[model samples]
Target: MAEEGQVIACHDLRVWHGQIRKGYESNKLIVVYLTAPWCVPCKFMAPVVDELAKKFTNVMFLKVDVDVKQLKYVPIDFGVDCGVESMPTFVFLKNDVVLDKLVGADKVKLEQLTERHATIVVYFTASWYGPCKFMAPVVDELAKKFTNVVFVKVDVDELKSKAVDFGVDSMPTFIFLKGGDVVVKLVGADDKVKLERLTETHATL
Candidate 1:
């Protein structure tokens, strides 16, 4: 809990599986840290996962305690199949599939896997527009809010061709792109709630 970024600890297996299902629908990468309250390596690795949560904003950071009450629900598909006998087992999942897994608290390989993962969010903007100026900080906060979405800024003046390609005629247009395609587009930044909800929608991959 001392860590920063959007890290959620679901002690309940049912709820955690729901979050995993959501990740599947969005096609975002799910990084699960299997830990226990008494495991020494799990304690040491907490800070590493926390830092990665901040570093890879395009990946969802989920912490699951193996010693939790819902042991029956925990080992069904992921844990049992992956042979998670050791503490601090790190699992990387994509498209409801287990892409890779690591045993023990090795942060090096985890970083490598994240660098080759999914999901990218790009923000298109122009430097001069008053609305864009007002929305800059708001969008940055949104980027921080969603760990699975990458928020990118594109100055229309600097990259006019890219702007034209995205059909961005206005000053401030928010485009949510995934798999190299536009999934959602919002024309204005007047409403912060709408901006946040829109980002939350596609933050998963």
Candidate 2:
């Protein structure tokens, strides 16, 4: 487990998997800091990453020392070959899917990317539900349109307990969250216009 507003160092493969799983299940963004002990640029960017972690409470920061023999196979489980040719690479992920990657130690770009991806929309739905299926494509389109906002699809059946936490009682529930707080919530399969309006409203906050 990681403390609030702190980076979680994954020295072991199991810990790495656990952290990513937890983040995916909770619909939170996972930022992986790929670094090695001897990398000078990585050393310089360490404090900046820590500061960003402190600022963005909702983002999960995982530090992986690539030199560690245990984690030599970094991101192999993500299904995508993350060819990290340089140190201090920042990889953004949601639901085990790689969203974006940044190479080198640029603090400004890192902070901007973090802020951009901070806005999240947690879409609660079930595969068997009709309304959920209907809204799936709409949500997918919105996700593509709003490149800055992260849209996470959570199946109620697979994660009933999580749905209960968010008080999701109906199919096709859209919960918009900025940082970690819920800013807006919509129920039912609303038309694309209404959903997009709410998404745009909260995403800019």
Candidate 3:
């Protein structure tokens, strides 16, 4: 419904920049909701993000319809390397660099995660792995409790190239990254208590 570069009114305006200079010069804190039209979760999270934009005046909210030709400039203009396997990929940018990213519509958790600088927990797994299924619930629960940490899951089967780049040799591999560097890695389904302790130990350092 919203056209490229057209500022739509909800709670904040969605800026589709024609050039990187325009996008970068406007603000320091930019939240871009890269979405598609048919995505149900995107439709649901749109309003929630708008509400958050209203609350956080320091940040600017923008919507990029991935379906549009104009939106293709994202990867080239911004140096974003990730593929859009799913819709409603929320990317938090600070000074043109990706600070945080959320793949799905976990609105409450996403808001909390983006509120501060925190460690990122990335779970790399495949759907076929039984251990991944076992780990999913645990990861979900941990994400809910750890508001300061950003939790992400990468389906290795779907994103094979990414998995290879990350050196994921097994299923349900959890990588804890701080400041874009890998600090710790836990292979397979791990105890929730131990995971929490690992996060705690990292957070204090």
Candidate 4:
């Protein structure tokens, strides 16, 4: 099954900070949005943030209200780190450390930033397919080589429902997923070296 994306609202300062500390890991990206209730641009950008949250399951999407007078650090904690000089600032972090920042409601930049951090691979196969059996070892080797990327194998016969969910109509189809989106699709059991090259090209970017 595909992982679902989420957006968490921060109502408390220390509790949200602690939660972020616990959830922040190397394999996932943390996206913190600094917004305010009175800012028109922030209000307009709210839906975009929600959409990004749904699209990027590997990202931790957080929304913080700067005007909420109740919280202390939630409003101004990472102003410098995130370079938040304005409302609706987007902060991207990795391993609890700031990696990138974006200002305003730019949908294109948001998608680009999310793509840069997500890494995943999905293989769709069936027992009746001979090429799928041949490609099993290559997939296993890829799982070992790309430790940072998630590798998934779906049996078309065993999980017919899931295969339909992923829109898989053929056997031995390989899907390259990033930020909960399919970036590439292959219909046959391609060569092992080409698979590695594909993974490397995406992983490094």
Candidate 5:
């Protein structure tokens, strides 16, 4: 549970939804963290989210506990009709409309999604895989260089359901999307040169 002026609880999801609606009536932005109690990653991200809320006063940070009985209406309210498939899923909203979604615990990716206001890039990878290991730094570097791009590294091994949902069959698969449409897809550990070409050809960045 969060203290006063801190994280908003899942029980208050509906109330916060109304508040966000009102805030949106005034053209304000709201950031919601949709999580579950049993999720280890969500537990790990609680403090980080708390600290970020304190830092960004203008942006409202609302925590939605998926496990909460009353909060079952969340996915529908947020337009996630496909269903709440992963934990620590961060949904960004502006004027009561969902702008983007982050399916895992990647602080940098979350920040960039908020900053850029662009489509999210979900990278399917794994920990033990060698190519994934090699491409991790490259993806990080690209995220740094391309500040507008939101890069999310999804561990296929950990999030098998998510991988299956995205139809990811290979390790180190890159899915670049713009406004929910996949702009590009790359499988395997892409080198810097190949990445540059892909970025230029597809994303035009």
Candidate 6:
């Protein structure tokens, strides 16, 4: 068993399949750290990833030693099409979807990516709406400022059903979701402070 905030190493094929499947099925964000023992860059980023695992307790960090002969076919089966071709490739996944990928030992990008996908904030907006246009920059700024929260901008015109499902009548509506459930809903473009405050609140939770 893995200690709190530590990366769970995938040395066994069955154990690896279980971890990936469970994490995806539950809508939890997962970071697959693909590495090999002889790779110097992987060595450099191992500690960095470990620290991130500790920082983002909500995110699952899984380490895969590519050199393990028994785990040779794991990457191909991991849904990272074409398998992992680079050392220290970080694949960010949620609900079996590849949200993002990073190659090499770029510590800053690694942390930023991990934090960005840890939590979600769905921003519902319409392109034709003036208020939505006004709030676009504000939302972008908030996303940049709050690295730990993901900002999903959905256009009402494009996804009318989604907007209706969220009960969004306004041009801009911010829905804070935890584990696919709505925790907070803000309907307006006038209050940037409230938006940022709420983002900070739900993100840290």
Q: Which candidate achieves the best lDDT against the true structure?
A: 2
Give the distance in Å from residue 157's predicted Cα in candidate 4 to where it truly belongs.
Answer: 19
Tell me the tens digit of each residue's lDDT in model 4 across 1-205: 1233667888777656765774553345678888877778787888887887776554667777766666546546666322344767888876766778888878788778766665767788887889999999888887666544556688888889977887889878878876567888777875667788888776654
The residue-by-residue lDDT of candidate 6 on 1-205, one tens digit each, is 8864789999988878888887765456889998988888888998998998787755788999877888877666654433344787889887777888898889999987876667878899888889888999998888667654667789888899998898888878988877557889999888989998998887555
Structure candidate 6, residue pairs in collision: none
Q: lDDT by residue for model 1 over 43-129, one digit each (tens)? A: 888988888788665677888877676754564456544234477787788877788878877788777766555455557787878
TM-score of each: 0.57, 0.57, 0.45, 0.58, 0.50, 0.57
Error of 2 at 133 (Å): 40
lDDT order of candidates, best first? 2, 6, 1, 4, 5, 3
lDDT of 2: 0.81
Better of 1 and 2 by TM-score: 2
For TM-score, the strongest prediction is 4
- True-structure RMSD for candidate 2: 13.1
Model 2 CA lDDT for position 205: 43
lDDT of 5 at 195: 70
Task: State which candidate, 1 or 6, has the greater lDDT.
Answer: 6
Clashes of each: 5, 0, 0, 0, 0, 0
Which sections of candidate 6 miss by over 4 Å?
Answer: 77-85, 120-205
Stretches of candidate 1 exceeding 4 Å from the true structure? 1-4, 79-85, 120-205
lDDT of 4 at 63: 78
RMSD of each candidate relative to the true structure:
7.0, 13.1, 13.2, 7.7, 12.0, 11.6
Model 5 agreement with the true structure over 1-205: per-residue lDDT tens digits: 4432366665765676675665465343457888887788888888888876564434567788776777777865765532435777888876556778888889888766655554356889889998888888888777655533456778887889988888899988988776456778788875658875665454332
